[model samples]
Target: MDKLLKILSENSAYTTAQLALMLNEPEDYIKAQIKEYEDSGVIRGYQAMVNWDSVPDAGVMAIIELKVTPQKEKGFDEIAEKVMMFDEVSSVYLMAGGYDLALVVKGDTIQDVSAFVAKKLSALEGIVSTATHFMLKRYKEGSVALVDVEEPTDGREMIV
Candidate 1:
């Protein structure tokens, strides 16, 4: 399991033969395990990681911090249901400390986004308050490998 997991996580597109070589297992045996896992719904499917930044008209993104009145009995389940109703919401998470729910959403424009906020999310029952912060810039995003940050120097060059 450890060997299989490492290979899967590091480079998911590796072939069965490549994985067999890495794990020091026979190709047929490794293939059988993969098949079994897929059959039982453990291994899902292969995917191509596209760098979607190259695409135009990608739209605006924002992170909305939501404070909601959780149902005394049902907890956050009810608020979560209302959040899912809005198509603009890409993802929602139950957060810690400051807010109850945090939404990562995308919209064509700021007005379109604020409309969703006014019509659907803010008006939803049990919603106490909301604070939205538009994502102005993304130096890095998604599963893109993070780069190392180096020490900064003074802008002016010292004369020798």
Candidate 2:
């Protein structure tokens, strides 16, 4: 991966001047490179990874594993597109084992999520089965730690 992309992935807030300084390149070069990346769709978009747990009533998140019968010609693409159209769905991924698709969904409560699965997702054609797991805690997200770092433990153990 390019150093420029790596730096942008870590912190997209960095300006072109800052990026050029870090990469030891001219500002014009940095700007042109970024422009090319964006034009070619290599750099999709930028967004802040918010700590939703810190916000009151931020809502519940669940991972839904779906088993579906792939279409003859379209395979999973058809069903994947249909699933992603729902507002509750945040992400959808095709899996290699156990399930066909893994989806990240958000709702106000477990009941809300369950209702969405029972009424909306399950109702879709070709769906064989669905399993939903509600998120209890987030220790890390997008390689960013959410919890406080603790001091290193000593090798010695208490005799008690």
Candidate 3:
């Protein structure tokens, strides 16, 4: 990955001036690079990773693995694009294992997700099977720790 992209991925809030200073480049250069990235679809979008567990009633997230028959001419792209159109879907990816596609879906409850899988996703053409896994908790996301775990206090004296 490019240094600029790596820094942006770690923290997108860095201003052009700050990024230029860190990269030892001019602000105009940094700005132009970022603009080119966006124009070329290299940088899709910026987002803040939220710790939903800390918020009450933040709803549920499910990882749905799908087995499908890829169209002769279109392959997986057709079905993947159709799946991406659903509002409940947040992320979708093509996999190389038992499943053809994996989707990250959000709903108000487990039942809601189940219904979506049964009624919407499974009903689509070429969809052979699906396995939905509900996320009970999220300890980390986007390489950032969402929870702090403290060491047990067993009253042991420090050796150092």
lDDT of each: 0.80, 0.94, 0.94
Looking at model 2, the pairs that clash are none
Model 2, span 1-160: residue lDDT tens: 8999999998899999999999999999999999999999999998898888888998999999999999999999999999999999999999999999999999998899999999999999999999989999877888887766674678789877
Global local distance difference test of model 3 = 0.94
Clashes of 2: 0
TM-score of each: 0.70, 0.89, 0.91
Tens digits of per-residue lDDT, candidate 3, 1-160, equal 7999999999999999999999999999999999999999999999987888898988999999999999999999999999999999999999998889999999998889999999999999999999999998898899888877664578978888
Better-scoring candidate (lDDT), 1 or 2? 2
Question: Clashing residue pairs, candidate 3?
Answer: none
RMSD of each: 7.0, 5.4, 4.1
TM-score of 1: 0.70
lDDT of 1 at 57: 74
The candidate with the higher TM-score, 1 or 2, is 2
